[model samples]
Target: MAISSLQEHPGSEVTVWMADGIYPISEPLVFGPRELGEEGTLVFKAQQDAQPVISGGVEISGWIKNSEGLWEAALPKELDETSGFRELFISGKRAARARFPNEGYLRVKQAGVDRRTNFYFQKGDFPIPVNLEGVELVFLHDWSISRIGIQEIDTAADQLIAVDSIGARIPAFFTIDNWEPHPRYFLENAPEFLDADYEWIFLKSQNKVLLKLPQNVNPTNSKVSIPFSQGLIVVEGEENYPVKNIHFEGITFQYSKWEIPEKGYSGIQACHFDPRPSNEGWAVVPAAIISIWSENITFTDCNFRNLGGSGIWFGPGSKNCKIIDSSLKDIAGNGIMIGEGQDRIVNGQPWWKSAPEQVASGNVVENSTISQVGSQFYGAVGIWCGLTAQTAIKNNVLFDLPYTGISVGWMWSPEATPARENIISGNHIHEIMNILSDGGGIYLLGLQPESKVLDNRIHGVKVNAGRAESNGMFLDEGITGVLVEGNLVYDIAKSPLRFHRATTNLVRGNFFFSDDSNPPIRYNTTDEEAIEKVDNLFFSEGEPSYQKELSHAISRWEKKQRKKRKR
Candidate 1:
C-alpha cells in the first residue's frame, strides 16, 4: 500500500491526483502516522485544471409513479436503516423531510416525564395519527434544540412514549414552563405528513423513499441523495511520530451525518450537542476532518458544504497546520475547531497537561469564508479554539450562523496556562446569533494572555425566544490580558461590548454602534482598572467624522427617558 510504503520511507514524497468528479465515500479515509511522508511535503490535490469532490452521498434513481401520483423509489439493499441518516438532498439542494403541520408549530400544552422515557402531552393538543411512530420530536429550549425519536403515540391518553434511552437525564428545573416548553414544535419523518411540494420521507424498515416532487422536476432527471457517512476523513498521529507534511488542495467535501447520541441529548450553552455530561458540564463535539496529534498538515482552496458536523478539527497535539482560502457553508456544527474541550479544563483549573500531546499550537486558518453553520447544533461557531495556544485566525468571513462567529478559549476561568498568545484579526463576522441569545460575534473565554482580537467587523444580532443577551464582542468570565482593538461593531440586541469578570485587558481604538438602551460597554463586576487602556473608548466621538446616526439615536433615547421621568 502507498501508506505502508510511505511509512517504510518516513520522509518520502507522494501525490494523489484526483479526477474531476464526485467520489462518494462510504467509509472514512484515515491517515495515521503510517501515512506521513516526512518533513511536510506529502500532498493530496486535484489534477491540474480539474475539480474533484469527495462526497459522502450516494445518488438514488429508478423512480416510478405511485397510484396516488407521488413518486416512489426503492433504496439500495446495501443501505441499512440503522445508519441514522436524517439528511436528504435533491438536485444538490437540501430537501425537507415530511413533517406534521408544516407551516406553523403546534403548541405543547402540558408535558411531563415518566418511566420508559415517555413525554405526556395535554389531551386534545396533538392531532397527529397514532401510527406515526419512529418520527422525530424536535424540542427547543433557550439555546438548545434536540431531535428525539418517538416509540409510541397515545392519542386517547394524549401521551407519546419516546424510545427508551437507558441513562438519559434532564436538568431538574428543565420542565415545562421551567426549562419552558417552546410554544412551537413539529414532528418529522411521517409519510402521511408528506403533503407539501419538495417534501420527502423514508420508509426505513422497507428501504424505500417517498417524495412529492416540484412541477417540471422528474425524479430520474434530478439527483436525490442521502448522506450515509458520519465521518469522511480522519488523520491521526502519535506523540512521538506525528503525521507530517499532509496537504489537500482544490477539493470539495460534502454531505456527512451526525449520529443521534444513544445516551440522549442534553442542553449545552450554544445549542451544541453535548449528549452526555462529563465533569463541569462539559461535552464533546465532533467534526468531519478530525486530525489528532498531527503536524504540518494543510488544506487550501477547498470547499466544505452540506455537512452534518464541524468542518475540520486539528485537535490536541496538532501543530503548525493550515486551512486557507476555503469555503465551509451550510454545515450543522462548527466550521473549524482547534484543540479539545477536555484539554481546556481540569478540576476548574487551566489544563496544561501534555501526555497525549493535548495541546493545539501554532495552527492557522486564514482567508476563508464560513457561514450558515450551527444549522442543527444551534450553538456551533464558525471558528472555535479550545485550550489552543499561539493560533492565528485571520482574514476570514463568518456569517449567517446561529451562535457566535469566532470563539476562542473554553476554560471559562482566568487561569492563563491553557491558552495563550492567540491571534484573531482581520475577520468579517456578521449576521450571527440569528437564533441563540447570550452570545457575541467575537466571543472569548478563559485567560489567554497576549491573545488579540483586532480589526474585525461584526453586526446583525437578534434575540430569539429567550431573555439572554446577544452582542458583538462578548468577553466572558475568566478573561485577562487580551487586546481588543480596531473592531467596527453595531446592531446588537445587547451592548456592543460586554465584559464579565474580565481583567487587565486593553480595549482601545474600537468603534461601537448599537440601538440598545444600555451603555456601549456592560462592565459587570469587572474592576475599573481591568482595562489597562481605554483610549478611543467609543468610536469617532467629537470629530467631524462622528457618526450622525448614532448621535441622533442617543439623543432620541435621552429625550424618551426624560419624558418617562416627567410622567
Candidate 2:
C-alpha cells in the first residue's frame, strides 16, 4: 500500500475496509487552531481479502490527527483476527485496537509543524497468546525507543509469532522529522583575545564574537551583553576557570552537560557570578535585574516560568547563593531548589549522595508565587532549601501543587555542617494534597539545621483523616533552632503543627482555629514550654496578652540571631 496523507472534510463520505470483510465509513478528523493542516476527512480501506493484512508494525511517516481532537501521530492501534483493517471500516464508530508507529526522533522547529506518524499492533488482538519480550520497531528516521508495554496483543491462533523485544512489538506510528544538528567549531590554538588576567569569556555564535574579561573581572566597571540573534554559542572553559560577569542580556546559553531526555537539547540558562573579595563573608545582597551566582552568589528579580527546571540553582562550589523574585511554574521538579548540583553523581553511591555536600548557604527567597505545575508527583513551592544553610524564606504565595506548598528538607541531615537553615515566614500556602506520602503546607524530616516558621497563613490543606496524617506544618527528628510564630492555621484535617522530638523549638503567638470543634496541635513539650499561647487572636475573638508578649519575644530573638551571625 502506498503511503498517503489522510485529509478529513466535514460531511464528506469515505469507506474503510478490514481483513474480516467489514467496512466502515469515513469520518471527519478535525485539526484545531493550534494544528497544522486544514480540516479534512480521512478514508481507510482494506487491501486484498486473501492478503489478511496484519499491519503488525505500521508507522505513520508524518503528522496525523487521531479520532480525538488532540493532534498526535504516535499511537499503537489494536486489531483482532477479524480485526485487520476491516474493524477500522465500521462506519460512525470509533475504531479500537488501532496503533500508530513510532516515527523517528526529531528536534522541535522554531515555528513550523514538523511531525511524523507511525503505527503499532494493539495487544489482545494477536492470533495467539504471545510473550512480547524483545521486539524491535524499525524506522526510516533516526529514532530510539525508550520503553514499550503490551496494551492488548492477546491472540488465540497458534501461528502468531512472539515479539523478540518490546521495541519490535510497538505498532507502527508516524513521527515528526528529526532535528538538524548544529555545526561544530574548534577553539584550538586561538590567540588569547584578552589579557591573561581575565577569568571569563563570552562568545556569541552568530557574530562569531568573543568577549574576554581580565582575571580581575568586576561588575562595578565591566558588563557583558550578548544579542539574541546569536543562534548557538559555545562557552569553553579551562579546568579551573573562574567566572566573572553580571549580565548576559538577550542571550540563550547551552550548558556543558545539559540535556532533555525527550527533547534532546538544553533550552536556555543564563547565569552571573559575584565579583566580591573575601569569598567567605555572610551577607544578603540586594535584588538585581539579572541572575547572579557568587562563591555564594544570590539570584533575584529573575523570572523563571514556562521553562524546564525554572528558578535559580546553586552548584556545590556555589557556597551562599539566594534566589528571590523568581517565579518557577509549568516546569519539571520543584521551584527554587537549593542544595548541591542538579545532576551530581557519586562514584560508588546513588545520585542522592552528592546532595549533602552541595551546601547552599544564607539564601533568601521572598515575594514569589508558584502554581499550576504539570507533573504527576512534582509541583510549585514558595521556597525549597535542602542540604543548605542560613536560608530565609518569607511573604511568598504557593497553591495548587501536586505535593506540598513549602517543602523544607528532604534527605537532609541537620548533623551536617551548615544544615538546611530554612526560615519559612509570612507566606500564604494552600491546596497541598495529592501524593500519599506528602506533608501538606511545610514538610521537614530527618536532620534540619535550623527552621523558623513565622507569621504564615495556611488554609484548605487536605490529608486523609485517621488513615493518614497531614499537618499545616510538620517537624521531625534531629530538628533544632525552630521557631513557629504568629501564623493562622485553619481547615486542616490533622494537627496544625506536629513536631516529633524537635528540640529547642518555639511555637508562640499563633492563631489556630478549626470547624472540626477540637483543634489538634501535637508537640512533645507542654503548652508553657514548647508553645507559648500569647496574644493569639482566634476566630472566637479572644485575645491572649501573654501569647502576644511571647510572640514579640520570639521576633526579638530572631532579630538578635541575625545580628549575632553578622557580627
Candidate 3:
C-alpha cells in the first residue's frame, strides 16, 4: 500500500495496526512526507500483546537429504545471484556458514610476496583438502575485518590467491598496515570446511543449499530462511518537507544480509560493507531501517536479529528520534546510528568545515539491549553518533562485541560542532572489544562541549595480546569540556579511562579498578592545561572497598551462574 493511498480526514488521525505473524517484504517499504495524515501523525504499530514480524527474507521449505548425507533444498532459480544471499537462519536461530577447524583460526605465514591480493599459509595452516575453490578468508586485524574470496589455491606452496579486488581499496588492508603471519584469520563458506552440524552452505549455480544436521535433527523440524533484502524500511523525506510523528512498536525484523563485492572486499571506518574495487569513494550500505530528512520518530519494544548491516540508521537531517526498550542481536554493524553521511578530509581540514555539515540532533536511545553487534564488521559500535547533538544514550546494556559499545563524534580534531551536549549515563557495558582491540566501552572523539558520561557500570575488557590495549572510556584527540562522573569501571586490562591530548575536562566521582597492577587512568599528554583529574576518584584500595569491588567488578557471566546456583 502506498502512503498516498492513506485517506486524509481533517482533524483526525490514522493508525495501521498489524497482527501477530510474519510479513516478509522483498523491497524496502518507503514512507515519504505525504504519509502524514490530516492531523499530521502516522502510527504503524502492532496490536497489543501481538508480535508482528517484518522480515527481509523468504522461507525455504521442501527439504530432503541428499545421497551424500547433507540436507539439500531446492532454491528459487529466480533469486538474483548478483546480490547473493549470505545468511541463513533455522528455527529462529542463526546458523554459521560452513567453516573449518571448527573452533579456532589458522595462522598466516605471509601476507603476500610484494603483492596485496594473496595470503600464504603456515606449514600446517592450509591443509590440502580445506583449501578449496570457493573458500573465503575472513581476516581480523586491529579494529577491522574483511571477507575475501579465494581465486586460486596452490597446494604446492600452501598459498591462496584472491581476485583482482582484494586489498585495493582500504589503506589498512592493501597499502599501509601489514598483518604478516598472524593467527587472526579463518577460512569460511566452503564444502570442505563444513565439518560441524550447525554449518551450512549454498550453491547458487546449482540452485541448492547444503547443511549437516545435528544429531536427532532434520530439516523437517526447522523453519529455514535466507535473506534476500538489503533494507526493510526507508523513510526519505524531501529537503524542506520532512516525515514527522511516525512510530513503530512491537515489531521484529530479521534476516537482512550483505553480499560481498565481486572485486573482493576491503575495510573502512565503521567497516563499510560496500564492495569496492570499481567504485572509489565510500558509499553507505543499506540498513534494516533508515530514516533520512525526518523527525519525531520512535521505535519501541522491537526486536532486530540476524541482520546484515546496521539495525537502524537515522541519517543526516534526521532528528528527535527515539529507540527504547528494544533488542538488537547478531548484527553485522552498528545497533543504532545517527548522522552517518559522507566525510572527506584533505590537507588537515575536513570537508564538513567548508561545506557546513548536516547534523542529526535530539535523538534518544534508552533502556535498550544491544548485543553481538559488529558480527561481520567488527569495527562498529552498539550506539554510534556522528555530528549529532543533544543525543541521550542512557540506561542501556551493551555487550559481546568486537569494538566499542557507544561511540560519539566523527572528527578527530578540536574544531567545535553540534556533536556535543550529549549525555551517556546509567548503562551497563561489558565483554567489549572481544575480537578487535584499541577501543573501549565508551569512546568519545573530537570536541563535544557539555557532553557528560555519568553513572554507568563497565567491566570485562581483556587484552588482545598482539593489539593495542583496551580501556573502559577513551577520550581521544581534542576532547574538551566533557564531564565524566559517577562511573564504575573495573576488571579491565589497562586503565579504565584514557585521554589523548584532552584538555579542561572535569573527571570526578568515578571508581576504577583493574585486575593487574596498572594505574586506573592513563593520561597520554602532559598538557595539564587541557585536563582535570585526580579529584574525588576512587581506585581499588585492596582493603575496605575491595570486598565491595568483588561483587561490582565481577564478570556478568560468572554473576549469572551464581544466581542460577542460588535458585
Candidate order (TM-score): 3, 1, 2
lDDT, residue 184, model 3:
66
State the displacement of the C-alpha of residue 252, model 1, in Å, after optimal TM-score superposition.
0.7
Per-residue lDDT tens digits for candidate 3, residues 519-559, read: 77778873754566655445664657775665664454346
Candidate number achieving the greatest TM-score relative to the actual structure = 3
Which stretch of 10 consecutive residues in model 3 shows the poorest summed lDDT? 172-181
Error of 2 at 347 (Å): 12
Pick the winner on TM-score between candidates 1 and 2. Answer: 1
**Candidate with more favorable, higher TM-score: 1 or 3:** 3
Per-candidate TM-score against the hidden true structure = 0.86, 0.46, 0.90
Model 1 residue 229 lDDT score: 78
Candidate 1 C-alpha lDDT tens digits along 269-358: 543444553434445557888898788889999999888777889987899999999999888778898886653554565447533235
lDDT score for candidate 2 against the true structure: 0.39
Give the total clashing residue pairs for model 1.
3
